[model samples]
Target: MVTGGAGFIGANLVRALGEVPQVSEVVIVDDLSTGLLDNLDGLPARLFQGSVLDPDLLDDALAGAASVVHLGALGSVPRSIDQPLQSHHANATGTLMVLEAARRHGVRQVILSSSSSVYGANPVLPRQEGLRPVPVSPYAVSKLAAEAYAVAYSACYGLPVLPFRFFNVFGPRQAAHHAYAAVLPRFVTAALAGEPLRVHGDGRQTRDFTFVGSVTSVIVDAIVRRVTTTDVVNLAFGARISLLDLIAELEDILSRPLPVVHEPPRPGDVRDSQADCSRLRELFPSVRPVALRSGLEQTVSWMSGHVLTGH
Candidate 1:
């Protein structure tokens, strides 16, 4: 069973999973909170309309599934800042419901789509799986709490679950204007529209932007192999790109000039972050992630051809 299977990453995973010969049944449950209906267009899966917080609905979804991939959550840092209580309930409480349901159903494997924001304010380079968490925002706090639950449940109940701490993931189908949209999509939309490309704090803040394809591959491999890594694995490209450089690359990709809109750094914002994915290497030995430039080019092309043209 896949929760939030209609969002950017989730939708992509559904498409990928459909191509697997061994997979005959795929069940998708989503509330459509931030996910788009268009993402589910070609998917061949049993669809259920419900929130992860609904225990009755969750129980129904978890029943009879061999495993569960929990990707549903409130996904924006700024949105969390604006509405802390709502974000907490959706991400933290929602995750607990999924884990509990999976445990009760005797599911073999669970893969959580965690975040890199959990390394907040640590001033750390290439965040490792073993580092002490210092989440900066309510969103990050919620993810960290969910990770704890996944780990505790693993140790206490022996439920095999793997958590992937993703870093700056971006690709097609990402909502550009949603309250919690990732920064890359928003910037691409602004750039394509020839509007002011907003930059917070001099645009020097760096991030390890992992491609969505690579992220999905890692998750699928983890699930297929029933990966036994106890610690939350870092899913990233192991390279950092500054926001200024990112904008430049986007402008180059778009073949246009980008205007600038400077703003004060928002609260709960981290200075810099990258992922140390050696642990992911150990878990999935054959999975080599793609580079940022190539990934960005592919994403920008898709957005321009599809989203921008409205075709």
Candidate 2:
């Protein structure tokens, strides 16, 4: 079962999981709060239009399920700043609901979608799982709290859970329509429309932008192999690039030179973040996710034809 299956990360994961022949059936649970219906178009998964907060629906979905992927959450740092209570309820409490449901249904494993924002403002390069999670934003706090809950559940109840800490993941299905969309698709859309790409702060902030395909691979591995180690693994490219440089690269891809408009950094935004995925290697020896440029090229090509053509 996949919660927030219609969301950006969740939707891409649904497609990837469906293509896996080993998997028989995939169930999707989403409230459609931030996720769009179009993201789930043409998917073979059983789509249940419900929130994770609904115990009854989750109960039904978890029944006979071998594993569960909890990806549903309010996924915006700035939005979380605006509405801390709502973000806490959705990311923290909602995750608890999924954990409880998985526990009750006798599911063997669950892989949670965690965030890099848990690193906070520490000057640490390549954030590792061992670092103390000093989250700055309410969103980060909620995600960190959820991570703790996942660990606590595993230690206390023996529920097999793995929390994947994903860095700036971007790809084809990412929604640019949302106010709090990720940078890649949003920048792509602006460039395609001949508008100035907006850069927050000085735009020198670096991020390890892992592709969705890479994230999906890690997710599938966690479910299939059940390689439990630190209970948290960084799913990232381990490569960092500044936002300004990333924008320039995207502009070059589009064959159009665009002006970059600088804006004040939004509150609850992190300065820089990279990941140390060495532990993941030790656990899943066969796991290797796609590189950044290859993934970006594919994403740009797909978005140019699909979203730009207005088809």
Candidate 3:
């Protein structure tokens, strides 16, 4: 069962899981809050439209499921800053509900979709799981709390759990026009439309952008291999790219200069973020992240088509 399966990463994961030979069926549960039903179009999966907070829905969805991929959450820092209570309910409380449901149903494994935001402002060069988490925003705090819950559940109930601390993830199907849209998608969408690419602060903020396909690959590996250990690993390319440099690369890909609009840095925004993916490599030796330039090219191609189709 893939919670939030209609979402960006979740939707891509659904597609990837369909290709696994051992997988027989994929059940998707989503509230469609930020997730679109169109994202799951033509995908072979059973769709259950509901929130993870609903106990009945969770119980029904987890029935006979061997593993559960919990990705349903209120996932934006700025949005969480504005609506902390909602963020807490969805991210923190929602995770607890998922854990409880999985435990009751005897689910073997639970894969949690955590974030890099949990390492907020920790000045650490490459964020490692061992580093103390100092969450800046409500969103980060919620994800950190959820990770703690996963750990506690694993230790207490003997339910195997794997929490992945993902950095900036971008690729096809990532919504661009939304208020809390990711940086890369928004930049690519505006650039394709010949509009100014908005840069918060001086655009020097660096991030480790991992492609969605690479993320889905690790997820599938975890489910297929039934990884029993309860561990949190960072999933990223282990490379940092400044926002300014990212724009320059985008301009190169588009073969045109993109106008820039500077805005004040939003609260709870991290300055620099990179990952130490050594643990991920140790667990999944075959994992290889897509290159930034190459991933950007693929993203631009997809965004260009979307723009052309007025989607």
TM-score of each model, paired residue for residue = 0.97, 0.96, 0.98
* Candidate 2: clashing residue pairs, number: 0
State the weakest 10-residue window (summed lDDT) of model 1. 302-311
Mind giving the per-residue lDDT tens digits that candidate 3 earns over 1-311? 99999999999999999999989999999999999988998999999999999999999988899999999988889999999999999999999999999999999999998999999989998998889898999999999999889999999999889998889999999988889998999999998888999999999999999999999999999999997566788989688989999999998998989999999999999999999988899999998778889999999998888755666
lDDT of 3 at 130: 89
RMSD of each: 1.3, 1.4, 0.9
lDDT of each: 0.86, 0.86, 0.92
Q: Name the better of 1 and 3 by TM-score.
A: 3
- Per-residue lDDT tens digits for candidate 2, residues 1-311, read 99999998999999988888878999999999988898888998888899899999999888789989999999989889989999999999999999999899878888898899999987798898889888899999999989889998898888988888889999987877668888888888888778898888999999999888888887877776765543688888588999988987886777778889999998878899988988777777786778777887888887878777753
Highest-TM-score candidate: 3
Cα displacement (angstroms), candidate 3, residue 32, comes to 0.2
Query: Per-residue error at 76 for model 3, in Å?
Result: 0.9
Show where candidate 1 strays beyond 4 Å: 309-311
Better of 1 and 3 by lDDT: 3
Scored by lDDT, model 3 comes in at 0.92
Ranking by TM-score: 3, 1, 2
